[model samples]
Each structure stands twice: as structure tokens, then as C-alpha cells.
Target: MSFGPFLLLALLEGTVMAAVLALTAVGLSLVFGVMRVVNVAHGEFFMLGAVGAWFITYYLPLPPGLAWLVALIIAPLVVGAIAALADVTILKRLKYDPEATIVATIGLLYILQQAALTFYGPDARPVEPPFSLRLQFPWFGYSGYKLFVVAAAGAILLAVWLFMTRTKAGLVMRATQVDMETARAFGINVDRVYAGTFALGAALAAAAAVLIVPIQQAHYLMGHDPLLLSFIVVIIGGLGSIRGTLIAALLIGLSDGVISMFFSPTLAKIIATLLVAMVLVFRPQGLFGARA
Candidate 1:
């Protein structure tokens, strides 16, 4: 078999997949970066976003593109608000005991999962892709929709990078990450920062879900894979490191996409997990984790 077209296709697919992973993983990294808390229920936020996008598209009686736009903006903000509320009400009190926070988040995860199942049913729901922007890449012979995913994700990531590196709020966030007490002493409102960070992180995940729903559809348990992958990306990228998470996500996305294209997705996933394990064994702090 000729390897030319297949290789090109795999590369394109890998790029697209990497974008999706980056969108989902960055939020996980951001939350850890700010609060030093690992949220197990992060995936549910993604599911909510997917569901939100689905409903907006299905019942809003609007054009698909407009509906998706509404979902992308509204879902993230809504989910982010919920997360912010959770942080203030529950997580803030448990800041001193991270283990307790972890357990609480796990419990929250179950609650969200069950709630989704109860409300949305156990079956996977289909999400129709928008028809307005069917960009055709004849050279690649692939769906224009895939390219749109790549472009949209890339734009979002770039925007996030700018927000983190360029804005005043971003600097405060970084400072808080380094030392919350010090940040507070310097007149930073630690509580507000924490709440904002959680909201921002959760919002990012919701954005990813909105972007993905047109392609992946909505389901109650759909958060499982993204949750696992987000954790892996955080671990591999060095927990709380945005740059590390982006790099790790790209690596994992490329490997998963290319390997799955050539072999079985199961094998691809196994290899991905093994790679992360190998990284952990050699560098427990993660590839870009801050050294003690």
C-alpha cells in the first residue's frame, strides 16, 4: 500500500486532535496552576458544555452557526460560574487540606455524572454540525469541519497564551500560584483570585466541549475520556505548568491520532498511557514541573 496520502491524512488528523486535547487539558492545568487542587469532576463540565451546545442547536430555532456561537459563549460562562460558586462554597474552606478537596471533587464528579444521566438519559445524543462553513480542502480530501476545529482551537489557545502572558490579571495569577500568602500580603485578594481562576479554568473546559460537540456529540458519560486525558496531560506536562500542559497535550494528541490511524485505538491509548508512566517514573515532577 502506498504510504503517501495516508501519512498526510494522519498528520492532518493528528493536528486536529491535538487542538482538542489542548483545549481540554489547558483548563485542568490552569486550575492546578492557581489553586493547587486537582478536580476530578472537570470532565462533567465538558459534558455540560456539550449538552448546552446540543440544546442550543437543537431547540433554539436559530441557524446552526448562531446556535453554536450562543452555546460556546453561554455554556462556558454558566459552567464557570458554577465552578466559581463551588470553589467559594466548598473548595475555599478545604484549601489547607488538599486531600480532602480531592475527595470532595471526586464526590462532586459522581453527583454531576448521575445528574447528567438522570436528566439527559444514558444514551449518547447526536449533535449536528453546522452547514454554513463547510470548508473544503480538496487536496486533503477531508472534511472542512476538521480544519475549522483546528483553527478554532488554535485561536483559543493563542488567545489564552496572550491572556496569561500579557495581562495584569495574568501576572497576579502567576504570582498567586508561586505563593498565595505573599500575593495576599501584596494586596491581592486571594479569595477573588481563586474564584476567578476556577471559573476561568472551568470555562475553558466548557469552551472545548462546545467546540467538540459538533464533532463528538453529547452523552452523559462522555466526560470519562476527556477527564482521563486531562489528568494525563497535567501529569505529563508537569502539574500547574501551562507551557508544559500545552506541550504534553500536543505530544499525546499526535501520538494518539497517528497511532490510532495506523493501528487500533486501544493500542494507541495503551501506548499513550505507558508513555506517561515512563515520564512519571523518570521525572515525577513532570517534564516542565517546577523543581523543589
Candidate 2:
């Protein structure tokens, strides 16, 4: 491939990375925005989704496409249910105290990790793509599934946007986010909103995992990098701004891709970490976040 083609390849790969990162970070951002809860275990939920997908597609008698479709639906539901349970059992009990919930979620992270290690074992496994088709460009061939990932992610994001902007449920969540006491005064069921928000966040992460698992293998430790990267993205994009999340994901993703292609993955990550530090120091509210 020529320099132009290679650049094109990097852009495509970057788009894929951005898609996954946006999906994951949006969930993290949403949780923080609405519940004011930092879910340290969010990445573990993502890992669970990948593991669940593998098991589902592996055991189901359906064909690859059908099995993947099934996995896509089931894994997120399972993970979201688990998140909801966690919120009800752990977070609610603590009354969603920021410090307490942080500690609780950290504990949840280890528990989930240990559980996965015990049950799923220590092997990295991949779920096969729903379909395998390549796009033949004049320069080179590219993954059609990757392109599909971008499209799917865009669709999901659009749906989420619509839900938040248009639905009554979304209005309730937004109201809760703005003022918990006022929302409660209005009989909005604050606890229920928190639980639902947590579940929705986990569901988004799981869906993202299911989409990307075909490209990346599933392992108990697979959550670590995504966790870090998602945090970075959330921080840089602004704490609760969906639009900011999307923009930051694209910037970080494309930079990571181009930098990694030219330099090294470690360097790319280091750069991202530095960017996070800079954002925290200079603009803690983030690019899109409003000053509190």
C-alpha cells in the first residue's frame, strides 16, 4: 500500500477504535452524569459481555450470524441485569455517596474479575464475526465487519440520543441528574432512576464489547485497558456530555491509531495518559462540561 492507502487504513482502524471507545465511554459518562457515580467495575461488565458472547455463540445450535445476533441481545441484558442488581444491593444501600460508591465499585470490580477468573478460566478467546466480507479498495482490502461496527455504533448512538432527547423516561433521568431532591419532590423515583441509569450504562458497555469481541479476544483481564481508555475518553470529552464524548473518542482514537502505526502502542497509550493529565489540570470541567 502507498502512503495514502496506509493513511486510509489508519483512518478506518481509527474509526473502528472510535466506535468502540465512544460506546464504552458514553456509558461511563452517562453513569457519572446522572447518578454522580463513578463505576469502577464498568469494564468488568464489558468483559462479562464478551465472555457471555463467546459462550452463547459457541453453544447455540444456530448458525454464526444467528448465534451472534442472539449473543448480542443476551449478553448486554445479562450484564445490565447484573449491574442493576449491584446498584440495588450495593449502591442503593450506600445512598449513592460518591466516596462510598467509588469504594464499592472498586470492590465490585475485583469480585467480578475473580469470578471470571474462576469460571471462565485464564484463556483469551475470540468470538467469530457475524459475517466475513472484505471491501476491496484500489489500494487494498479492508474489513467489512469493521465498517459495520462503525455503522452499528452510529445507529446505537443515534438511538441513545433520541431516547435521551425525546422520551419521557429520558426526561425523568435528566431531571434526576439536574437535582435529585427536586426530582424526588416531583415523585420521580430517584432510586429507580439510579438503578435504571446504571443498568443502561452497563448495557451500553456490554453491547460495545459484543461488537468488538470478534476483533479482540475475550479474557478476564481484557477489561483493564478498556477501563483506562474509557476513563480517559470520558474525562477528556467532558464528564456528562454525549457530544463531547463522541468528539473526544474520534480525536483520541485517530491519534492513537496514527501514532501507534508510526511509533508504538505503549507510546500511544502514554500520550493518551498525558492528555488526560493535561485535561484534568487545565480544564477539569472538560471541553464540553459546564463549570460547576
Candidate 3:
């Protein structure tokens, strides 16, 4: 293939990656923004989503399209419920102390990993795409499903944006994010908000996992890369800044995809890490983050 074709392929791949990464990183960013809790187990939630999808499709005696559709609806809800349960049972009890939550979430991460290994097994699993169509470009054809992933993720992000900016529930969440004490004083149930936020974050991760599972097999350990990349995106985008998170995800995803296409994945990671280092050194608040 010519360089132009290769580059075009790389760009499409990168856009797909950015779509998934944006969903995952936005979840991470939302949790930090609202609850000020760094969820180390966030990636595990993502892994669980893929696992959930696999389970749904495997045992459900339905058509492939219907099974995938069901998984898409159910996995996020299941993962979100799990996250909410954890918040209620663990983080809430700990008073959401930043340091304490970090340790707590780390523990949760291990527990979830082990649970997956025990039940889901160590083997990787794949989910069939809901559709199998290709769109022919000038130089090549691409998976219609991949394009759908991009569109679906973009729609979800937009819905989230609308929820946060337009809805009363969103207003309450924003209030809590601004100041929990003040929000509580105004009769907002801060505890419920916290639980909901955690659930929402986990749901976003799960949703992303479901979307990408067809492209990448589900495995117990698959969350590590997404987790690391998410942290990088959140850091570079400015913690809690949704717009920044989306932009940074695109930047990292595109660069990683292009570099991996031409060079090595390891080299791509190195460059991403280097970029993170530079961001930390030069603009610790992130590109779109407000001054502290």
C-alpha cells in the first residue's frame, strides 16, 4: 500500500481509539471532578465491562446483533451498579479522603482482577460485532462497525455534555463538585451524588469497553493499557476538564496510532510518556484546566 493509504488507515484507527479513550478518560475525569477521588480500580471496571459483554453474548441464546445490543445495554448498568455498591460499602465509609480512597480503590482493583481471573478465567474472549459491513474509501475499505463505534461514542459524549450542562440533576452534581458543603447546605444529598457520580464514571468505562470489545478481545488484564492511557489523557487535559479530556484523548490516540503504524508500539508509549513529562513540567494544570 502507498504511504497515503497507510496514513489514512492510521488516522481511522486513531479516531476509533480516540473515541474509546475519550469515553474512558472522561469517566476518570468526571470522578475526579465531582468527588475528588482517584479511582485506581477504574480500569478494572473497564475490564469487567468487556467481560460482562462476553458473558452476555456467550450464554444468551439470541442472534448476534441482539446479543450485542443486549450486552451494550446491560454491561454498563451492571458495572455501574457494582461501582455504586463499592462506593456505598467502602469509599463512603472512608469519608472519601483522597489518600484513603486511593488505597481503597487500589484494593478494589486487585479484588476485581482476582474475581475476574477466578470466574472469567485467564483466557481472552471475543464478542462478535453487531454488524459486518465495510465502507469503501478511495484507497481502501474500512469496517463499518469501527465507524459506528466512533459515532456511538461521540453521541454518548454529547449526551453526557447535555446532561451536565442542561439538566437539573447535572446542576446538582456540578454544585457538589464545586463545594460539597455548600451543596449539602442547599439540601442536596451529597452522599447520593457521590455514589451516582462513581456509578456514572464506571458506566462510561463499561460503555467504552463494550464498544471496543469486538475490535479487541476481552481479557482479565486488558484494562492496564486503557487505565494508563486514561491517566495520561486526564493529566494532559487537565483533571476534571471534560473538553480538555476529549481533546487530549484525540491527540494521544492519533499520535499513538500513527506512530505504532510506522514505528513500534513501545516507541509510541515512550513518546506519550515524554509528552506527559513535558506537560507536568511546563503546565501542570493541563491545557484547559483552570488555574488553581
Q: lDDT winner among the candidates?
A: 3
**Stretches > 4 Å off in candidate 2:** none
Estimate, for each residue in 16-108, the C-alpha lDDT of model 2 and write its tens digit. Answer: 999999999999999999999989999999999999999999999999999999998999999999999999999999988999999999999
Displacement of residue 116 (Cα, Å) in model 2 is 1.1
How many angstroms is residue 16 displaced in model 2 relative to the true structure, after the best TM-score fit?
A: 0.2
Candidate 2, 221: how far from true, in Å? Answer: 0.7
TM values, all candidates = 0.94, 0.98, 0.98
Report model 3's TM-score to 2 decimal places: 0.98
Off by over 4 Å in 3: none
lDDT of 1 by residue, 1-292 (tens): 3587777788888888788889889998998878888888899989988987777778898877787788888989989998898889889888736799889988888888888888778888777776535444445456787788888888999999999889999999999999999999999999999999888888889899988887787998898899888888889999888888989888888878788889998998787788778978899889878774
Q: Residue pairs in steric clash, candidate 3?
A: none
Candidate that beats the other on lDDT, 1 or 3, i.e. the better one: 3
All-Cα superposition RMSD per candidate = 1.8, 1.0, 1.0
lDDT order, best first, reads 3, 2, 1
What is the C-alpha local distance difference test score of each model? 0.85, 0.93, 0.96
